[model samples]
Target: MECNKHNQPLSLYCPSHLMPSCDVCISTSHSKCNGITSLASVVEKTKIENSKESVEKDINYFLSILDQLVTSKSKNIKTGENHCIGVKKSINEIRKEINKHLDHLEEKLCQETDIIWNQEKSKATDFISEIEGKRENLKEMKEHLQTVTTNTSKLQSFLGVHKIEQQVHQCQRYIEDLENDERTKEVDIKMKQNDEIENIIGKLVSIESVGEVSVVKTEINLNKETSLRRKAQVKSQEQSNINNMTMNIETKIKINIDKTIRDMICLIDGRFIVVDWHGKVNLLSSDGKLQKQLPIPGDAYSVTQINEDTIAITYPKERAIKIFNMENETVMKVIKLGKLCNGLSFSNNSLAVGLRKEEIRIIDLEGNTLKSIQVQSESYLYNLVYCDKRVIFSDSRGKAVYCVDDSGKQIWQYKQDLMGPEGLCIDTYGNIIVVDFNSQRIMVISKDGQDSKVLISKEEGLVFPQCICFNHNESSGFICDYYGTYLAKFNLSFG
Candidate 1:
């Protein structure tokens, strides 16, 4: 420790002010203080006063309080959202009930209308039948009178004519009676809507809104224990500037394989999953030692971790993506694709796959596509990373890196001269760490893609650098070279 006044090393302590001081401070600030002790003696006495277990207990107590607060607040948020969803469901149920009742009333009215129509038709039909019968009777009597006049005696003709006249008179009387009856008038059907139902419908339409919800006051108890625990992955207090950072190689571990290394990813526990071009995946320890080799058949182009135990890989030749269980070392599921699939990224429980064509498909685990973005790249895109609704990928043939939105609209692109950009990863400060296969180097581009700097050169023992990944804290990282050669472990520092 140093002195604030003289800029000299501090070795003495002022007990009155509880401050450490140098010689200059002792003569100036501690001149009036009594019993100023040496800092070394004070440290020795503190070893007994502040034990390691007691300090740990104090830290644990603070952590417990913070954990409870976070859990209760998160639970309350979820509870409030669920309550809103329940209220919306109830509203839909009410609308459904009203519709059901209206449908029943409509059907009943239709049946009543039909009954009235049938009754009117029956009355009109009966009148027509009675008129026809009377007319036929009169016609038959007249024909008998004509036959007596032509072939029988005068007395017979007279009687027949008299009977025909009586029959005609009766027919005329029946016609008159039909015309006099009110039921003989032309049938006219009319419809009348119920006034009560129309008024109810108008009332419903005039109302502005459904209803309002009652608010309940919530009280959060920070001391209470919560069932849900929060995982606090606290990082170092020092912040890093993307513009001023350094990459220093710490160790280089040679791999036993000979094929080309295509892609790699850093795991949660500081391990790595690297893939060879020939369908082989190796799980390496934090120190770059081979722990296990996962038996995977077919050409694996890219790989991404869905979780600690699950991983998804794309097979170009197979035109599919296979999910593997790292714990069991078995293929759990396979998602088939019609086009050739290359790059892979797991986001929001779905895979964002880059096809050999000009399209990128977002699909679920069951191979059902959720979205497809059509890029305008002329070359084939290989490695990619998806974050913040943005898809960043590299086109090896085009020698360019692209940043595009979810709908494939261009944001910005970085083109390194004759640089074969391969796999890329995002750093803690949103900078992009991309490797160049042809240049045999590594580059860190600003998150905006407006500026870039060559972080690692080929002279630093890098041969055909293919993929790069950093740990969670960006304290250390690994750079994999092509041809399955080796993994270079490096310590990362930011100014």
Candidate 2:
């Protein structure tokens, strides 16, 4: 083989190398062979190496993808299996719950059906029993009707016989004859008895005892004696009753006078005020000594002690009210009302004045009217007393006493057979005491609006009680009589 200057083989070298070469050269040439066969061999070896590496790389990538796919498929299968199991379990649980609910519903339905069946059975039994009872009653009625029909047929058959009719007529004629004989005998016996009675009466009239009794008039005398004795007894009883009533009245009067002299009349700070119906305002001492006599400008309807030294007076005729200061002996304020004034009271920093037209006017101390309350009434307002947020008054026309709130709404009212209610007072327990003018009686009514009890019916010792006042602390009251010239007192007690 020939080698080139670069020591390549002739076949591996370029076409320009055409020379002989040594073994080393041949070896070097073969080592550095540039022939097509050598190049083809190198390319085939590199392709095999690259193809093996590529196959190895592709195998690794495919194995990795297969591993991922297997892992994902296993996970998905497990998830699907678990989901199926869960679905089966959930389905089983739902079926069990449905079975339980269905069982409960079936039990409830069975119980309700049983109840309805039992009720219907009972109703059917009752209806059957009722039908049986009605059938029995109908059978009994049929039997009774058959018996009644048989009796009626027998009566009809008996009534149809002519012999029986003739016998009945004969019997009736015999009865009439016997009745006539009895009547004749009765008349004859009556005549004989009358004759016997007349004879006995004649004998009795002729006897000395009968004639002596007639002559003496014993029965008339006995009756006269009995009547006289009865009259005497009655007279004695009436006299005894009169004495007892008189003593009671006297004792009550004395007790009342003593009580009124003690409790109702009080000396407030050495200034004495006499509560009376007179027009004059008498300022007296504790010993009943008149100190100053101040004549009112008009008719003094009411007198109230405002304080230790102040006194209020209502003059209805003048339609005015005046406050008198005893210490200064001067008038503090004078208020002229537009309506007729009747009664006055001081409470809760205000003056409550009663009017004749069934109204109450609340005024301050300075003579300013704050509120006016119209009392519902069919009569004139006679008197009023304010206590416990209630205004109690008497109505002359209605013959009753009424209590109203501060707003003029009626709280209670008591009707009586009084001729006219003139004065009214409330006790400590809110009992109403009324003075009747025409009936001449002291009527006491309970606070709960009951009937009026007659405390003093007639003025046997008293002329006429005009006004009344109560001492709440003592449970006592006083009444001023118009003609008695003294105040009567009473101590009240519960029955």
Find the candidate with the highest lDDT and give its number: 1
| TM-score, one value per model | 0.50, 0.44
lDDT (tens digit, per residue) of candidate 2 on 1-495? 444465544343221243334445546554554442433344444567666787687667667766776787688778777777776687678669968996996798778777776776666676567557656655665455444545466666455444445655655575577556532242111112344455455434423231110111112111222111334433321111111111123222322121111112333454345544335566654333556666446556567778887878887668888998877788888889877675787777788887765579888889888878876555545477776777887777667788888877777777758788887777665667777888888777766665456777774555566766665665555565653245555666553
- Please give the lDDT score for candidate 2: 0.60
Could you tell me which residue pairs clash in candidate 2?
2-19, 12-35, 256-489
lDDT of 1 by residue, 42-140 (tens): 887887645676767667877988888799879889999999999999889988998999899889988988999899888788877876887678677
Identify the leading candidate in terms of TM-score: 1
Stretches of model 1 off by over 4 angstroms after superposition: 1-241, 416-418
- Which pairs clash (backbone N, Cα, C closer than 3 Å) in model 1? none
Which regions of candidate 2 fall more than 4 Å away from where they truly are? 1-278, 284-291, 295-298
